[model samples]
Target: MITEFAPAKVNLSLRVGALGEDGYHPVDSIVVFADWGDALTVTPSDALSLEVSGPMSQAIPGGEDNLVLRAVRLLAQASGQDAKGNISLVKEIPAGAGLGGGSADAAAALRAFNRLWELDWPLDMLAGLGSQIGSDIAACVWSQPLRMTGRGERIRLIDDWPDFPALLVNPGVSVATGPVFAKFDEAPQTGAAFRPQGDLIGALQVATNDLTAPACAIAPVIDDVLAALAATKDPQLVRMSGSGATCFAIYPDEAARDAAAGAIRQVQPGWHVFPIVFRGVSAITPT
Candidate 1:
């Protein structure tokens, strides 16, 4: 049996562009992974089978439509290999919290199956196959901090990224990505690319999530969550991570982040407040 980790994705900086001729949305954003996320295990089997279990597993579908299954099928067909295995998904990331939970699961499956089937494919090769399953899959395959553009197929690794501490808070609500993009198109913004400043906080000050406004329109609770994070005495920057509902605040150090998370949890007990150290291009270590 082989086990692979599916880290929760967080868009440290997301900039959405106009709809493309292919009917896909162009996006430029910085994606990060959380050390604490879903996990998947794969073992050989005569037939493809899947079992889902975890804190957030109930919210995920256990069928062919699941991204994990689709990823396996796509890779098998593309590689001309038999797609037979027993796949188990242990979901920890929120389903529709703009955390790229499903995408990460699919990426993890691809990674596991590549080795399970002895494909010995590299990250780029696996990411190419992942794009067929979903746009986010390509980015999730790397599971690191990188710039995603051109409908999320483009991946550029970032350098000299500061190790900022982050607090991710979800107001126990789900925000669908499709609707958020649709709303953005209804009344689009200038939608420009992110320009990095000398410092992380400086760069963050200029970058923003284009889908935040529309997302708030769809789910008012998202606005409340943002306000709550913003109220934190003095966070470096507070904004919606992706689309909506799950907002993050970057701090100068881990101590500050933990304090902020604890204070928010005390006030919004129902919210899912997580304190993590943002290891850019790496995994977020939980506090």
Candidate 2:
């Protein structure tokens, strides 16, 4: 059996450009991995099957439409390898909260199958396959902090990224990406463009997640999360990560993050809160 931990991703800096002709938004953002995530286990089998279980398992789809199953089918068809396997997903990240939990799970399956079948496919090829599953799936395949642009398929590796600690909070609410994107009056039309300034950490502080406004509109609780994070003193930046609902506040160190988490939890006991340190791209430590 092969096991892969699909770590949750946080968008340190997400800039959504105008909508594209394909009905997808062009994005320029910096993404980072967190210690919290889901788990995927693959075992040899004659037919493909999947079961999902975890704290957030009940929230995920369990049928053919599940992204994990779709990913496996896509990869097999692409390679023409008739591979089959049974996959078990232990989900912890909140679904539809903009944490990219589903996307990460699909990416993890691709990586596990690549190793299990000895396909030895290049990472680029795997990532391209992932894009079929979701925009964020390709980035999750790399599982590293990167400057992502052009509908999330374009990635640029980042070095010298500072180890910033953060507190992630979700209000146990789900927001749909489609409605959020639809709220935009005009699709952003910036071509693939990114200008990195200062160090990785500083560059992230300067950049912003443009999707926050629309997301917060759909789920006002997201605004509450941001307000709660901002209430804590010394938070480097308080903003929503992706399309909606889950927000994070960066701190200089773990101590500050821990303190912020504690304070937020005390006030919002129902919130899903986690204090995590940003793992650099090279640190592939599984969640």
Model 2 stretches astray by more than 4 angstroms: 186-194, 283-287
Worst 10 residues of 2 by lDDT: 185-194
Least accurate 10 contiguous residues by lDDT in model 1: 278-287
Model 1, global lDDT = 0.85
Q: Please, what are the lDDT tens digits per residue for candidate 2 over residues 169-257?
A: 99999888888888753444343455777665565566777878778777888888999999997898888888878999988888888
State how far residue 187 of model 2 sits from its true place (Å): 8.0
Candidate 2: lDDT of 60?
Answer: 90
What are the TM-scores, per candidate, against the unseen true structure?
Answer: 0.95, 0.94
Best by lDDT: 1
Say what the RMSD of model 2 is.
2.3
